[model samples]
Target: MERQLPNFLKNYGSILLLLLGIVVGSIVGGFFPEIVAWLKPLGDIFLNLLFAAVIPLLFFAIASAVANIDGSQKLGRIISTMAGVFLGTVIIAALCTIIVLWFFPVDAPQVAQETADELLQGNPGDTWGDKLVRFVTVDEFYKLLSRENMLAFVIFSFLVGIAAMRSGETGASFRKFLISGNEVMKQLLILIMKIAPIGLGAYFAYQVGTIGPELFGFYAKPLGLYYILGAFYFIVFFSLYAYAAGGKHGVNRFWRNNILPSATAISTCSSIATMPVNLSVAPKMGIPAAVANVVIPLGTTLHKDGSSMSSIVKIYVAFVLIGWDFFDPMTLLTALGITILVSIVAGGIPNGGYIGEMLMISVYGLPTEAIPAVMIIGTLVDPMATLLNATGDNVAAMLVAKFAGARGTLSAADGLNTDDADGTD
Candidate 1:
């Protein structure tokens, strides 16, 4: 216990301090009221600093991780299984958001809408094809470099990584540069995080004091909904998934071993950081080391159920601000597609989904004001997000084990459209 105590504090100390700062600031803002003017600027400065750094950080992180794919992803069958499970789970999470938002719609923040208005004014009548094209790629290379072109940037980074991988020995220097740039961005993120407490505190103060209760309500509704939905999904969906993986025993083993990892994810607010715990617990649940080794590590960056749910909420918040119909069939479908993309890429970019938020902005043409309102949602809901993100990987490993033919693996998909005479199975 003594040995573990230092590690525990080392992991949680910063988070605790940041929470304290937010709490203290909120109380002052709510009661004192007069100090929010100065406090708001501190928050603005922090957010501005964040927005400036994330572009390069996202680029390097995605490109570098993809470049290293040759080493990290060796298990071919397990990779396919993980992909299937990851996408299925995230889609379920997003559909849950759709249902919840229908009953409990979130309103736009009561901040000034003039800027958003100007940006949305004269909404162009571009064809669906043009809109579709712009959603994934920009016409010019320089346009892809900006925050407003996030999806374009993501696609470009992916291509660059794949090109490097395909070039073999000739691309070694470029690969190294990508990795080194990724490391530098990580350090830059660390430097930005060091000021998180003060910035969050200041922002919370201003929000409580002057931004109107509606703005708080703007965040509160989604935050509350997320916890309720997260808990529900964690218990119900995961148990069902475990049962599918290995019947009653799998369910029992998963619950018993999952508590610590769930706790770690919520405390650390990081899927990557919680991965060691998942790796440690996988064997006790009867998951193959091969499955755990592949699923848990790759899942850290590629699988994201929590982010899927939150992405919908974030997009809905923007839709409300823009006066769009959230329940429109086409809009809901578009939201779902974007949610999946965000969940997948969000892990790679880090910084609590700000890059994901940027993706939302670019794809939908959301205005700049949406950034402040939506970026904090990621941080606020991160504990649950990380909880879903991390533990889902563990459960996924179990499923991957089953899919790889560990005792009575689920094979319905293979049976659906195949014939024994074909001999493919």
Candidate 2:
């Protein structure tokens, strides 16, 4: 029985279990709609568990990685490389989304009056200065806990980490403690994931049961096309990036190892939730923990390849719905700039698509009524967007590691091995 149990788990792990749940939930919701509300808590509990761990995990993981850096110069090089890779990928994704929309355009559907009113109520009338301030600093430390201000946390963590690195002997012991704490949090994440099937199954069941029918309605075609394009981009473009970073063998190993993490991202529809899995699996793909620790956490907040694609699609749809002339060169350029900026500020929080939608209204000078239409599109493509976002982060980590000279092993250049008295590699 014991041996059989292990084999059973191996065959029916979280991915299979979550898929099964989605199927079963869809069936149940389709036939018995009354039960979906009751089943929602199962998924909510699971999501809450993952969310609870995200901030601390990010803090310790990033702080430890930075503290281990040999000096500010190496850190500067890695940061620059990471930023370049992130920008290049986002631009490519944005261009792909634009081209796809150009070929297969969507006519915006009329949104219900109630939905428009509800969406408009949350508009903050934010200015560029307000947005910039929010990204760089927060009014209170506790506000950093909110996912909306995650970049602020990244900045704070970097400062703390840099200070620790310069503290000499005292910093070594603190870094070790952080490493230990990060390991503990990772274990906690694994424990939470153990019941993912049960949690996700219930959640998906409620989702499909409630929204399954709607998915086949008017929103189906454009959303469906977005999913197909997203898949293509993820598989082809992401693989190419990986190959560039790690070579054919490295790319092969990455795809081979990341199947489960990809599935996790799809199911949860969150890059933040999938960070634990990404961090855990990165070392196996030849990314040193030091690099993975920094890249994955920062990427979760800053990288938005998937969101860039979705935002482009949403903006295109909005233009069509409102009869705005998007073909004007200056208008097109402005839209592209706004899309990239939105992606940068979108963060790793769940339901962050709305923030992008708000930007669309403010930046494009669209009617507040357009909010509901943009948000509806966002909801439909969120899973695919998140899958792309999470997968891109891992790929970016590989490229960053490669650029930093990580070659299938840990070394000082890779930032995994620090020059400390303990000789900790």
Cα lDDT listed for each candidate: 0.77, 0.69
Task: Please write out the lDDT profile of model 1 over residues 66-155, one tens digit for every residue.
Answer: 787795576667787788988898899899988998898776665544334555553378888977787788888888877777777888
lDDT of 2 by residue, 253-365 (tens): 57866886787787666788788888877776777776787788889877888899888878876676555656678667767776776665556323456555655665555
- Superposed model 2: Cα runs more than 4 Å off: 1-74, 108-218, 407-425
By summed lDDT, the worst window of 10 consecutive residues in model 1 runs over: 416-425
After superposition, the stretches of candidate 1 with alpha carbons farther than 4 Å from their true spots are: 1-9, 17-41, 107-119, 200-210, 321-323, 348-350, 406-425
Model 2 alpha-carbon miss at residue 200, Å: 24
Quantify how close model 2 is to the true structure by its C-alpha RMSD in Å: 10.0
